[model samples]
Target chain A: MDQRLNAKDFEDALPCDAPDSGPLRWAPPEAPLAMQKQVLETRTSWADLALVGRLFLSRRKA
Target chain B: MHSHLSPDRPTRLCRLLALSFSLIAAITASLLMAEAAARDGFGALDGARAALIFLTTAWLAWGASLALIGAPGLQRRRAQPDLRMPQPRTVILIPICNEDPLTTFARIAAIDASVAEAGVTADIAVLSDTRDEAAARRERFAFARLLRETGGEGRIFYRRRTQNVGRKAGNIEDFFRRSGSAYDLAVILDADSLMSGEAIRTMIARMQEDPKLGLLQTLPRIIGARSLFGRALQFAAGFHGPVFSRGLARMQGATGPFWGHNAIVRVRAFAGSCGLPELSGKPPFGGHILSHDYVEAALLARGGWKVEVDPSIAGSYEEGPDNVLSFARRDRRWCQGNLQHSRLLLAPGLASWSRFVFLQNIAAYVVSTLWAAFLVASFVATVTAPPPNYFPEAHQLYPVFPNTSTREITMLVFGVVGLLIIPKLTILTGAIASNRVQGFGGVIRATSSVLAEIVLTTLLAPLMLLYHSRAVLQVLSGQDGGWPANQRGEGLLGLADGWRSGRWIVLVGATALTTVYWIAPDLLIWLLPVGLPMLAAPFLIAWTSRPLTHALFRVPEEIASPPVVATYHEVCARWEMTWKNSPAEPSAGMAVEHHVPA
Candidate 1:
């Protein structure tokens, strides 16, 4: 019979309430296209604008 | 002809001699510049200009060195004797991120068919990192249709990661963790990548021949370039790129290049040595190494494995950005990633060559800023120089201007141009001599194409300089250019679009030229080359974005489309009909977003 290791029996397994390493890895967060556009329009800093203003200025929408 | 298993003593001597010659040329230029500076009373600005001249000269010399090393290898072809041993199990991994599924999977199918035709048993895995729900649905449907059409039920697999951790690198790592143990070799491909049956077999056989080889990268030629910018790049890659690659191969030796895709890796070696650990702190400097390919190669080399780039292998192909905006957009991500390698410069256990390669990668971006600074310093020197001192107080015997005479300056300029142009000419000459110019439409047409490439690149250099300078500035300011989906196969950029994308470039160019003119009109002659193209940047971009006249820059690939490219087109044609008839509803259990883990 194949034995299954329960959460309590495993060396590193966690309980249901225990916290895990946040996301396991850092991925560039994804958002909807609208949100991405909004962020590009608003969150982009002045330094960034001065450097690559063309990309931001060419945005089709606000 | 000759065995190139490893660069022999004479080849090594040739590399050293080439380096020495480059140094001598650079030193001669620097000495002349220094003499002129000394005559000008050698101020801080003059000193800065001198430094810039030295760095620029050395950089050009490196290219010259590569040309010297590559010239001899031009006609030398590595013999790949047929392997009678049983072929190894290989898995082709295609990682897609929001690409057109119909085309992407269609390419995969074509590659699969090629592999099958070669009698090479290989499993195909389409790893999806796509985030959009609609795109994911389309990918699944397209993939299902692919399996059915190709009869690749068990051989081909599609798995979309719920969380695309660490972007593409993470996606590959995830696959490795789950089921990588079953395969001996993993051939990685980008969505746009295609390889012919012969190229595939050669790569696998080469790896089999050298058990110490951990990774083998191919020099993928640019194909499917439609727009004028694309065609120019395609021409350069098909022509100049190979000679340059040969030199690069000789230089890299056991430590080699991995260009992320169209390369094969030893599965176990990659699984063990390339488990990337995130850098401490945030990005633009840290976090997941965005330029993972180079670092992975370095890691493999560090683990006592050979990573080599075989430039002689043909038929590997990929697409390039079609226009300036698209090119700049792609460059933004790469610039950030390469700059991020600064943190790993002194990381423990890296080979010395690996560290130097990292520095070279960093310099690839940093040199733009230096060039920009040099230009600024030159402007300052021009504007601030004291009027020509024909008489040096009462001590001078004859009237002499502190600044370099027009003739001397002209000579210096010509010297720099020689450094830049001579290598390219040598490569062209070598190509003709080696009977390799036939593919590029014979000697006459190839010569014309090379001249056109030079002209086009000269006009495009300043724009690239500005783009790279700005990118370096952004990276320094801690701005992370998050991974963006590559925009491919676009046609000519509209005038308005080009203007919008290149407005800042024109603005800066115009402003700089006006400033120089206002301060010192005589220097305008010196600045025209940099200024005029920049002022007309938007227009120039719009012009180059369109089709070239009469296939003026037509590369051999465009002149005679390869059979694989034709096959790809045929596959796409069939796909158009299949897509029209297939039902539109999302298949059951195919909701990509729903599979996301909490």
Candidate 2:
């Protein structure tokens, strides 16, 4: 029963993203929010062993 | 012998025979002197007798050593293992200074294509020391474009130095720092170095089999020798030099020379021990060790790694210096670097094998200086001293003063002649026996080329001796032989500069010989084999780069052609394709570009 960490949980741990935080902002507001969220989700899925199995199967067939 | 001589040519043949005999007589005289000197005193001889005796003895010993090494019996024993196998992943490093990028890139591309066709996995890196940003950018762009077009983008990498701290050594060190950990082994190549893909595969297989072995240095056969000077050197290196190197290998046992390139070294061993030490003194003999190979070999040996020279490995190649001035410039640095080994000879904690090598390095300089002095002293003594009487004064303890016996003299003549000619005969025999004769223009051309090479070598020997002697003097006088990047193309002789640089030895030897000749015509005639060549240097230099001579002789074709590589390529190609298809990291593409076809 190993605990799994999601992207939202990781981002929330950062001090700059906290609700009370001020005077510290590195990210630009105009950046594509949907693309960024998709990228994070894709990265999170890669950490799963099932994804590795699928990738190997695809490579062998190719 | 008499029946073969024509009436007109009898005298010429006789002179040749006499010259042969005199060389032997000179050697015997020296040996007898050494024997006598050892019993009573060597110091008792007048300076002239001493010098003549020493020079003759040194030449005789060296010649005899060469003869022994080239003996058929020795040749049969010097066979290498037939360890040919499929190629392994190879990293080829071409270390360059501010050389022409176009020529360098073209050569690299040619090698790349050859390797690719052979199907060998190769990583090529052009390690450049050009500090100028513009020049660096130009090379980078050229390399990038070449790689892209050739489909070698991931296999070729070009990096320039921000700081050229240690020259060639520093450039290589930087590469090792970045990417050395990735490759199996690195083939350190000079800009002028070019080896066949098959030869590379053979070297790789040999390395793969012998994991304990650290390096395998191939004897580079000279190619592209367009100039007369270059051609002569090419001939000597291809024909006579191998026998001497075989002898050196025999004597060196485990501790052999690493001649920088045309060789392979284990990556880990090189990284661990090849970091050179900064000398505590000034330039010429000190500062950053100019000739790092010798010291690197020593360091490798000290670290319990084996460094050996395999002269039998074929197809390793390099270009010779185009002319006399270019050669002198190169020799000047070599002289200083070799002289610097004197300090290492005294260093402690080194293995006995390494110490012996260090001694040999130092002796390379010392012996040259000694021979130079001996040459001068011989002439001075011959002039001032009275001639030797045929009959000697009797001593109370001995019945007669020991003089050279007629029997000994005859034996000496045969021995000296055997020493000079037997090595060439052995090489000819080896060429035939090995069936390498078929590759060249068969037996006839090989035999004729060998004969021509001997005559040319004999003429050039004295000139080289004179040049080396001057280098020795320059090193001893504390004049720094400024390090120049090796000259690539042919050019006219800078006559005034050449004269200024070489005048000391030339003037000294010419004046001494002239004075000696005036006093003793017999001695002068006896010394003509050596004297005539030195006197003919200016003419030799002027004609050294003549195109007509090169074309007529077929000198380039005789020496420069790569050995047959069909079977070697087949084996390597099979291995490389198999490796590529296997699951591996995404190809970085840096490794194959150095060998891409131009």
Candidate 3:
């Protein structure tokens, strides 16, 4: 959840030594920690698990 | 200066030979034990027991083999550190999550001062993934104070992410993508990590001279332990950590481990190779990788780069959980992380050794469950075994049915028990041989510490086994252990809390002992060592967590802290004093400025 930042959120981030002009130019743009976001490439697939699942389903049909 | 293939051939050959020996010996021992069981017509229960024995035995022997390979002496580094070289563009990155802001920032201030004192240069960055607004407010003020005290305006940086994407690993990756290309190298530190300037200088020099070295991991000695549990953990790590690491280093060749902190990594290489892809599954086996350090190292190795560990690099330190509950909590996360590697056992394009390392990581936790299963199987086997032929040969004069398997079974049990001793003995021998025992209070103290450690671990092993067993079952059942912030500087567990957490364990211990006594009185004696401790779980937990003011589990660090550590302690004290005396809370209004001690 992206927190709604406000005046109180930055309430006491007052700089002790440096000038307070910068709006805490702290971070670069946000980057997602998700699996690499290439739509087709980022599928979380485990080949072995998939194989076992197939075998289980096949057995059930029989 | 660092040539990868020219020198490591002998090390590789030795590793291969030892691993082969481990595998063959494990198989042989298991087969012999299985045959012994089948001597009197093996049942399905016997088969299951045999399998469990094999797994546990393999796990034990493999561990002992590492101690065999790792000489107790410091591992020699290939790249001769050239301190004359200009300091590279590097940033010491400390990624924190809801950590105690005052102490964590104090470490940074001390480290910054130490770096200046060494006449070296490196920037420090604190990447905060703290979610709570109140904690974030505390963190920002803490950073402001650190900057003012260190006069590190342009050099020091602080950032907090509102949307915490990937936890620590993601936080680090975010740093690299944002500012990593600006630096040639980066030193990764946990919130509790504190490294001296000299150590920083050495790592940088070694990294600069070697073009192919991707990461260099330092052995972060545990410091600042107060409770008996904390000190015992510290002593064990201080004594056994290096020898095992040295052994691990020799076998690793080009591919080494990344313990997530107190290590230097080539910025570009890590940026390129370690953009970790989240796993496909929902949790436990998927989403973000929990043990990202191991995977990162493997990825670096797969990318044809050298990753290494240099245990001789001292002055790097971190603190641990002070009590049993905290330790178990931290351990549960690690347990889940390792077990999740089952999905990656056959991941493509990995170094065979890397995959094997993954297996060993998984086995480290799974072996506990195997031990639990073995005990259950043993009980069932013993109970179901044909009743002793009381009337064999028309009422034998003595009711002794001539126990035949006693010697064989004892020898097998003895062999299994003896394997656990070999590694400890080997490490001690190496420590004594290399005259490295002095750092751990010389011969007498070190020996006693070892004995104390053995007792501590023996008493705690069954309790941990129960925890590990639960952790494994939970993970298998799709329970995800979210990345919880480490509970540092807090470890006192009251009797009630201990009982609340461990009542099931005590019940299990009592039930097992009672059942065994009624059915097979002889086996009751064999189970006493493990069973008794579980029965006293709450008491042991409470007692070990109490603060100790003794000289029992002292490491060299406790004898006299390093200059950096001393400085950190001073800074932490001042910060705490300032916080206590502050007239008003930050929310209230303007506050008095802190005056740091010179």
Candidate 4:
């Protein structure tokens, strides 16, 4: 239903700036190549995906 | 805003008119049909028989429509995914008035363990209204020790109000005012609530998903329903309760129900919108809101926030009353609280959907009254009407005698089947699909348990109906059925007290059925629908435990495993321990602490 947020829009909404200073990092390296491709193709925001991905990773570590 | 009820007034008037018209139509149709039957030399006996069939069919149709619409509405609402996520910092408030501290502490510890396992960091506040300095100190120290033992040292804290103020709501508000700014959300828990890790995580995620979501309530399954009556209640709740709630959810959507405990709310939402308005009255409907959950949900909805029930969510549990009287005691307070919502039905700005939910609550009360009336009517008809004809005067009376329409019979059969069987089938399906049947010693044992539960519930139904009827009468008459804090013990009822409270229903039902049977021997078969259940009440109540029922059923050893019995046993043990450890003295000092200042 709703439009997927873009990187710039997500960045503006973030409480703090990202540590990365590159042009724009859009996909996680550890994600499967197909998933990464879909992320890029779908215009999924990096921040929103990163937050969920990070939470999952933390859960696994715990 | 000018006081205007124009929009709602017209709708309310229309609804009343529709109800009146339908009732009048039903009466007219039945009377005319009876009159026509009488004129055809079909004697008064035949007319009475025709009337009975028509009335029964009408009752079945009414019940079916309610189930079809109401059940789906509840289900659809519960199906919505919770969107709230975990905030970094939050407060979990557990309000205790005069409850057992150890029991409360153990449950909190269980919840604390579950939350930590979910990796959600939050502070715990034990808001005690116990005034005694010594007892309060003891409870606080016990909580502190339990927290540290469980690796939650700084995260767990305690607070006691010097003054009780406005009871539970005030106790929470006091905390919010003092330390409200420190947390983004608050999890309000009852002293008895036991939530699992996954449930907590899901609830937090739901809150995170929707910022405007004020509350997320989980349907609580009964925990310690050990007695026969209690077990029947447990099975009913664990089985049929979800279907009815799932139906309610479908109708209410986001603005469903808030059942007080086992739910989470946003801090800002609580502070801004959930402050309860005191009613100008006395006991039963007044003082403080006895049942605050529904009113809180209404307030949250009024303040433009979503409040919902999620029945699919699991591991939120509460205990059921062990016997009929205990249930009546609890229901008396509930009846008053729900009846109070009659006023809220007309409150301004509520979504029409929420008002519908309020109406459904009232409908539940109405059903009790209607059923009682039907029982009385059936008794009167049995006494006054003559026996059925041995040889029908109109075997060829085509449309007049209309060979008991298959549609009506099927509708009646299906309604009974759906209410009794479908719920168990649903749970069995869920368990099988999830592969959680391992705990119950495979398929056969689980099936037997379902069968046992059905028989147990059937026998106990008459008793419950009678208890609820008395409760309805008390509520209607405005009697103060004071809060009989739930009995958490294994103390069996004294036989005399049990008979005094329980035997009257059985006597009345049995007496009516016996009268029907004596007058018309052929009617004996139909009387099973009412008679057998009443006769089995005492036996059912006596053998309601898992161990006892299993033994009585001669369940196979493979199915009646130690683990299954142990689960029930542990519940009993906990209740007994709670009772045995109650404070020795009146604890007058503690009483003073919980006394709310007028």
How high is each candidate's TM-score? 0.85, 0.71, 0.88, 0.67
What DockQ does every candidate get?
A: 0.01, 0.01, 0.14, 0.01
lDDT (tens digit, per residue) of candidate 1 on B1-598:
1123344565466557766876787677777777776665788888778778777777778777777687754446779855446888788999899887767887888888888877778888899999877677667667766765777766788889999988999988887777776778889999889988778888889889888899999999987776678778888887888878888878777787899999999988888788887776788787888999999888887777888988888789998887888888888899999998887777666777788788878888788888789889877876777777688689878887454557657878998788778888998888888888888778888889889888888898889999999999999999999998877766577889878888899999999899989998988888889888898888878888886543455566666776677777778777766554544533232322111110
Please state the error at residue B369 of candidate 4 in Å. Answer: 2.4
Q: How close is candidate 2 to the true structure, as a TM-score?
A: 0.71
lDDT of 4 by residue, B128-198 (tens): 88755556544554454354445554466666788987677778777777777677677778876677656
Q: Candidate 3 chain B: minimum summed lDDT over ten consecutive residues — where?
A: B589-598
Model 4 DockQ vs. reference: 0.01
Residue-wise lDDT of candidate 3 within B1-598, one digit each (tens)?
A: 1345223775777587667866766676667667766655688888888778878887887777777777655356554576655568888999998777777898999999999998788888899998877677777777877866876776888998777887899899888777776788899999989999999999998888787999999999998888889889998888888877878878887788999999999987787778887787688988888998998888887677789888889889998778888988988899888987787777666777888889989998889999999888888887787765656677467664544666667777777767777678778888888887888888888888888888888899999999899899999999998878776776578999889988988998999999999999988988898899999999989988988764677688877779999999899887777765543134221111221222
**Each model's total of backbone clashes:** 0, 16, 2, 29
Of 1 and 4, the candidate ranking higher by TM-score? 1
Number of the top DockQ candidate: 3
The Cα local distance difference test for each model comes to: 0.77, 0.61, 0.79, 0.58
Interface RMSD for each predicted structure? 20.0, 26.3, 7.5, 26.1
Quantify how close model 4 is to the true structure by its C-alpha RMSD in Å: 18.4
- Report the Cα RMSD per candidate: 13.4, 20.3, 5.4, 18.4
- Model 3: chain B TM-score vs. truth? 0.93
Using lDDT as the measure, the top candidate is 3
